[model samples]
Each structure stands twice: as structure tokens, then as C-alpha cells.
Target: MITSYNFYFCYIEIHEDYVKAVMKEGITVSPEHNDVLLQIVEKHYKNIPFVYITHRINSYAVDPTIYLETAKISNMVGFAVVSEDPKQKIQIKLEKTFFNKEFKQFDTLELALKWKDDMIKKYRD
Candidate 1:
């Protein structure tokens, strides 16, 4: 079963092996947002491995530093960003630098979901 959540800053869909987040337009995603993410992880993911897929349908800014605290989540197997914007692609490069684990970029949500499955399988194996 897939569960969905609506926050002021983003909308999230939680699946068995992944969490897909769609951030609000024009907002800066900072470390503070990770608190709600951790709560979701604790409640739904717990010990199970899962990937985070950010479906960037709307324009937004992200604080690269947020990845530092996110890297501390042991069960988080990967982080995937999906965006068609060329500019967002460039921003991803800088954001990837701050992340210590598997980080990937995709032009579509389908591709990101595929990566999420592969990441979870790799983590389990």
C-alpha cells in the first residue's frame, strides 16, 4: 500500500521501498525539513531500506548542507532527483557533492523509480 502526506513545504508518497517527494515551488529545502522526513522514516520505514526520490516538478531551491544530516540515516539506501529542467540538472551536481551515499539524477520519475528498486535490492544483498 502506498501512503501519501501533504506538508506545507512538500507532498510525499511513501511506498514499501521508496519515498517520493514533490517540494513546493520557490521554497528552499533546508535541513529543517529533514525533521519531518525522519519522522516519516521512523514511522513507516524503520529498519527496512528505502530510497528517496525527489520528483522535482516545481522549481525550488535546496540547501546542499541538508544532505549531511540525511546521510546519517542508515536505512536510506539512495537519493534520486528527477527533473527535466536543464538548470536543475546543474544544481544537482553541487548537491551531489554534499551527499555521502548513492545519489543520482533522472529526467523522469519512471527512471528514478527504477533506480530506487535497484538501490534497495543492492542494499539488501
Candidate 2:
């Protein structure tokens, strides 16, 4: 477990080549949210293409405008979002126009993790 600190809204796991973030419910995602994520990336992941996987397990509000700036983060190569909610899926579609989500929304975390592995494999090869 990541015992560094209690990141209330999100719990993150740093993989070999990707970061998986599981967001909590009833929260709002804003520009400030990126700061925490970036800190993790800077501390744990560097000198490599950055991949982000978001497991949306609960309802939350994400600022649509923030996606643009989020894309500009250094070395951001890909993104994966997992959610079964119809509303969230639609939002993901809208988000696709701004970001390159090679591994888009999946109904389950297992499927998303598989896709992340495939992405790493492809990147390695």
C-alpha cells in the first residue's frame, strides 16, 4: 500500500510505466487536483512516457476545461479511464477530442489494466 499520505479523493498506484488513480465518490476534480497527481509523477515516475489510468469508482465532478491543461503535462503519452456509468462514458467521449486516450473507458479495472499492459508491451516493442 502507498502509505505516504492520505490522498482523500484518490488512491494512486505507481506501476512500471503507468499510474493508476482510483477516485472517490462525491468529489470535484479541479485544477488543484492535477497538482497532487503531478507531484506523484515527479516523485515516482520520471524520464519515461507517462501513462495515466483513472478508475472512476464513484460519482465526481470533473472540470471540462481542466482536461486541456492536463494534456500539456510533460511526457503524457496515454490515458485510460474505467467507468460503467453512462454519464461518465459520455464525458469520456467528449474528453477524447482533447486528449489521446489510447486506452479509453472500460467497464472494469481488470480490462483497463490489461489494456495498460498491452500499451506497455507495445511501447517496449
Give the number of the best model, judged by lDDT: 1
Question: Total clashing residue pairs per candidate?
Answer: 0, 0
Report RMSD for candidate 1: 0.8
Candidate 1: residue 7 lDDT (0-100)? 95
- Compared with the true structure, the alpha-carbon lDDT of candidate 1 equals 0.93
Error of 2 at 3 (Å): 6.4
List model 1 lDDT by residue over 1-125, tens digit each: 48999999999999989899999999999878999999999999999999999999998899999999999999999999999899999999999999999999999889988888888888878
TM-score for candidate 2: 0.83
Instruction: Please give, for residues 1-125, the per-residue lDDT of candidate 2 as tens digits.
Output: 33333488777877767788877788888879888887877787676776788888878888766777778766666788888999989988887787644638899978877887787677667
lDDT of each: 0.93, 0.77
Error (Å) of candidate 1 at residue 40 is 0.5
RMSD of each: 0.8, 2.2
Off by more than 4 A, model 2: 1-5, 101-103
State the lDDT at 52 in candidate 1: 94
